[model samples]
Target: MARNRFDIDENLESPFDIKHFRRAMIYIRRQKKPMIVAFLLSALSAAIALSAPLILQHVVDVTIPEKAVGPLFGWSALMLATIVVSVVLATIRSRIMTRVGQDIIFEIRSDLFKHLQQLPFKYYDDRPQGKILIRVVNYVNSVSDVLSNGIINFILEMLNLIFIAAFMFAVDVRLSLITLAGLPVFLGIMLMIKTRQRRAWQAVSNKSSNLNAYLQESISGIGVTQIFSREKRNEGIFTRLAANFRKEWMRALRFNALIPFSVDNLATIVSALIFLVGLLALGPGEATFGVILAMSSYAARFWQPILNLSNLYNSFINAVAYLERIFETLDEPVTVSDVPNAKELPPVKGHVRFDDVTFAYDPGHNILEHLSFDVKAGESIALVGPTGAGKTTVVNLISRFYNLTGGQILVDGHDISQMTLKSLRSQMGIMLQDSFIFSGTIMDNIRYGRLDATEEEVIAAAKTVCADEFIREFEQGYQTEVNERGSKLSQGQRQLISFARTLLADPRILILDEATSSIDAKTERLLQQGLNELLKGRTSFIIAHRLSTVKNCDRIMYVSDKGIAESGSHDELIARRGLYYRLYTAQKMEA
Candidate 1:
């Protein structure tokens, strides 16, 4: 397998449905037994708490009137025992809640990371790296918090509300039902809050993504900013993006804070009205001191539960939106993937044939139109044409980076599409015009081409491309540090290292795309001799501008608008006086 990479595009088209929530719920339900136990424990705890007011009435009405200190001490001991039992149960329930919260957070984060692996390359191409990283890190982290503590608190709050209501009704049914009449109003206010919460959370997500993208773009081009003295201008843009981000954050914060506070007050208001109604419904004689006190305590206990429910609604909205974004990326169809039942490519002699293959990045503009050609095993072919005349496109197709729009390309007489992309590409090697320098030591970059190559083999490969001299000159030699994008090396030197890396792979097929363009004439002359040796017993495709490059090709296929307008050795093409002849003569005249 290739190195593990996390370059998924988080802004993929929304592929979210009810299915993601269903998956998330699977983890939520695992704590069902514990939740049920917690519910019962909380109910008992609330019952014990309600007994406090009742015990007070008992002490006043029964114990004091009896004039017995013995009975008072006995009643006080019972109260102490109830408190102790409730405290223990409450402690156990809290621990269970914590476990459930932690487990759900782990599940959400794990599922999110797993989904990222199946996303397509086009997703990565479309978004900024920073935005994607933030989604994987901060956004996922936030959603996990919503799922964990948010859901646990929500469940416990509902249990608390239910038990408190039951206790109130037991005290005085008429007063309990009448007092509960304001429940509809409480529900209505919470529903309105939920609507605003959804919009606020959505805005927060969008703004976060934007801010991350802006930061990434600014930092990546710090070189350009420093060169043009545009730091002030870039800073202004960043400041504006940050300001907008803060506005979105503040909007979410205000609504979330307002909803919980409003609900707390609403519960308080509801409880106050219930007390007045109870006093009216049960006249002074009918309402005992014990019953009235217990009912009042239940009403106040209702607020904590109500506020928790409101906060739960707010958190769930954010989690759902986050899950939707994650699902969008996961569902994106991988544009390039192995075909079902694809056969592994057998060992090949490196013969390549393009049979009427056609392709275009966009419709109505073919990069290669009905392009057909074949090169014998161990033969060298040069593709000479103006830029974007399908030279690199043809090579890219052969490497299976992009599929052909029409026709078939055969490697060793078998269609490339029928072969496993990995097996087919393993036999080919490429050296591009602009080399990519990955952050590592020089030795690490070279080993990237062939991981199993030995140290001696690596040194030999560098020597083959005449790169060993400069490499040895460095204090660390092969281990010399190469910064990200190979910034430490010159263009010519990077190209030389790329050549050495490719040569070490010992591929059956070799592709050189303007490989010699970056170096000086003296180095080019020296490398031309090395390329001649390397080309032997290998199928070679050379895309070059130097007229001298194709001099030794077995056969030259001169690419042009007309497609392979001329073919033959160097001498034969000059006789034709076509595109190749004209271009060749023009260069000599300029010199």
Candidate 2:
């Protein structure tokens, strides 16, 4: 009644859950035809191997004793043929099983990646990237061999044991019983060791996950570490993580080594006992050399399968630990899936409405409460707010990145929740402060906005945002390779490239959250002319800290405490002398 190491109270199910095993079997079922062929080949190989002792018995007792040269030659040839047949069958079976394993790995990895893409943003927000990567990459690789080679090999070994046991009993039950006297002791030892071995392996897997997470975090933030002169401190942390991993790994290694060592010593002792019993039980007419030789061979064969089974069990335990992690990820609920009967959003005129909408990242702590507002088509509105006033949250709501806690958000009279996410978000263009540039050519990064855009179109879009002049100045021009996150480019240049990319998408609704904050005053003035022309017919929401950015906006709204504190044109708000006026005056004085 001892609790399993893997079981947790929250699971409410056994660690070795039937559902998880059944799901794994679904992947195996895909290659059922090849698996059946491999099974038959394994059986044939085992049968051929089982024939070796019988042929040796015949040669020792009959052919050699009679001095029959013809029969001796024939028996030798038959023995050689059995060896050849066993080798051929084993080789073919191995190839087939390898293919089946690789196929299952491909399918599982593909499905995991596709599922990750479909999962909502909140799912990623709650999990570390390193932990997710370990499940997707390392866990899948660990289970591959067990699915392909472990199960099939274990079955074949069991078949060999059964066949050897049957042959031993047929020859003489008394000797067979004597040869297997050590088996009960061996089984008891194995049972005692298995739980400890499993626990050690599980510890190893957990430590490996932690090591991977730390490495990923440190490498990705190496810049910050270097700038802060914390290289030695970070190295110390890494050494500690590595030491913990090595400690658990050594424990697992000891457990794995003990099984084989015990089995080998037991086999030798058992063989010696079988030989002694054979010698004592033999009489002039009662027993022949053939019987003694055959039983000796069977005793050796018997322990070989047990040894193989032990090793396979060790591997299975380790694999199951990783399998549990993988299945846990696969079972994560997608909380933001589309409605069952959701329809695609048609062409939109860009009118957005928030009616009594309330939202929170967690329960009982609202970020936006009963926020009601409407933006007219083709209007440019600027959101000016103090820090943490939820300006970004409003932009996220407009794009349906998170579901509202209460009420509804609508675009062109259709509730966004009732529309397919793809159809709803495709027509919206967003440009943020930290524009992420993928590792690719400048042209490739820009072309990502519209995958099928022609070269001329890409050039035109860059020109519209004044990104073309600097791009052409580079030696590689449009083909200039950008390092990860545009590390080689200045902040202003990265922002311009992002602008060019979003401009190429030609979205009807645009969201710019401090998009030009990195641009110098002269550059900002130059880009402002192009932006004014681009915003002429599009509905745009701009979140800005600078008063100059909102001065040209049709209306400016001051956001505070999850509600609009003031709303009007820049001039109108200045005349009203409220929160907006005070904020603008402070910025003016700082400038």
Candidate 3:
């Protein structure tokens, strides 16, 4: 066998820098009409607030002399209308913003979950499960919060700023300019806060992941802690991690909270400055009492948006960091997908060949090297080896669960990688060392072997594997609930159910990896009989931790610490009196 070679790409990068900002804007654009109306309503509300003094001026300086009630009633009605419109628009704006935030967050969560499942096995091996979960959660919440509030608040503030400036200029341009000039100083303070906040947020994220990892590992390994009597030690470590997380969270909140308060106070001080300037500019008869009152209101309004923009700036930076995290997950390149022009596997005659196969999970170690082997139609082979002798690795390559690093695995003489992954695996049956049963009825687990299999077919498959005997003893027989991962069943029974599942599929090739390692001698004997019947006309690979399980295979390969040290039939291999004979003698001696 020749070593199969292909390129590996390791430079992971985020999909795009701007994915989060665009997601936020999509909502704004979707509700553009309603948002525009809300902006106008907010603007009108500010305008009406400014108009109060103008109306007072008219009543005192012009209307009262005319003794007219008409102007007062008309101005009062206009003010009331603007207030009502603003309230309605504000309500609509809140509802739309909430909808946008939830929808975008939902999209992110769904895609992230799908990506996590699609990632190759090696990815999971390298990353902590708890940390990965925390990243997903933190990114979703941070992005959603910043996006929803930032867009609506920033837009409304800008509109409010525009109206207030217009009103102030109409009444007293000089005072308005003096008040507005002070805003740049507030912006400078916000910029400094933003810089600190970014570092604080990063610390928050790091600590959150660490805390979650600690909690998850402790809970999952509580059995080990109990056995070792290390419960107190584990709890103390967890408490310390949680405390550190709290410290990081508070530090971030302190910075996050300080930016807004400082901006608000600056806006207030600028308003006071405007009041001082207004007093001097509006000396006797130059401006009415009404004009001075209205100028002050406009001056205060002008500073509000500056404060808002400052808050929005801080939010935007944090949201962008979260967006970057989200895009990073989505952007991970799928390494083991089918070739662009891959075709479906044709009907099989059950022949498998490993031609010059060498593989390594990492660049540093070659787990399989030049392992050339063949399985002809209707032949059964056993793989016997100590841990890491590549028993499972050879079978994994044939199943195409992981692409080869340096070899060609063929099914019916066609390169397995050139076939669609679905097509290649559909023709094979696998019973792993650790079986998984979804939460469903016993019949459903068996039916998973072939979705379209009939009820009678399911029963037949179960009977063939000798599972029907105990299955019928259950309260509901085949319909009995398996519970999650078949926890409701005994280990031997779970093994029996998996056997029935594989039988129901009628696969052309079967790979059993330590399939009966957990069953007692009586159950193992029954399973062995059932397996011989099951493999009658198929090419099969069987891995057994116990040598007794390999007695009937036509050819058995003794995979030793070095490599294949011996290969022959049960009788012939025993005659050789080599590694296989010694292992057989040891098992008998123990028994």
Model 1 misplacement above 4 A = 1-12, 25-125, 149-153, 172-175, 193-196, 278-293, 480-482, 520-526, 545-571, 582-591
Q: Estimate each model's TM-score.
A: 0.81, 0.93, 0.87
Error of 2 at 219 (Å): 1.3
Candidate order by lDDT, highest to lowest? 2, 1, 3
lDDT per residue for candidate 3 within 1-591, as digits (tens), equals 011100111122443245556655764575566555645655555555556556655666676778778886886787677667666756775676677667667767887899987787666666656766765787687777566657667776887777677777887777667767877776676667766787676666666667776676676667689999998887788787778779978988887788668766766776676666656655676766566666666666666676677667767766665566666667666777789999989989899988888788878687887778788988999998678888888788888878787778888899988999888888999998887788999999999969999999998988877789999999999999878778788888898888889878889999999888777788777767777887999999999878888888989987764346678898998998988888889989998
- Cα-based lDDT for every prediction: 0.77, 0.87, 0.75
How high a TM-score does candidate 2 get? 0.93
lDDT of 2 by residue, 1-591 (tens): 111111111121236566787899889888889999999999998898899999999899888999999999999999999999999999998899889989999988998888888777777776556777888899899899888788788888988888999999988788788778888888888888888988788888777877787788788899999999999998998898888889989999998998888888888887787677777755555557688889888988998999999988888889888888787777776777689999999989999899999999878889999999999989999998899999998998898888899989989999999999888888999999889999999999998979999999999999988899999999999999999999999999999999999989999999999999998888888889999999988999999999887798988989898888888898899999999989888988998
Arranged by TM-score with the best first, the candidates are: 2, 3, 1
Q: How displaced is residue 560 in candidate 1, in Å?
A: 4.5
Residue 493, model 3, lDDT: 86
For residues 437-555, what per-residue lDDT tens digits would candidate 1 score against the true structure?
Answer: 79999998888889999999998888888788889999999999999878889898899899989999999999999998888888888888888898899999888888786788888
Query: What does candidate 1 score on TM?
Result: 0.81
What 10-residue stretch in candidate 3 is worst by lDDT? 1-10
What TM-score does candidate 3 reach?
Answer: 0.87
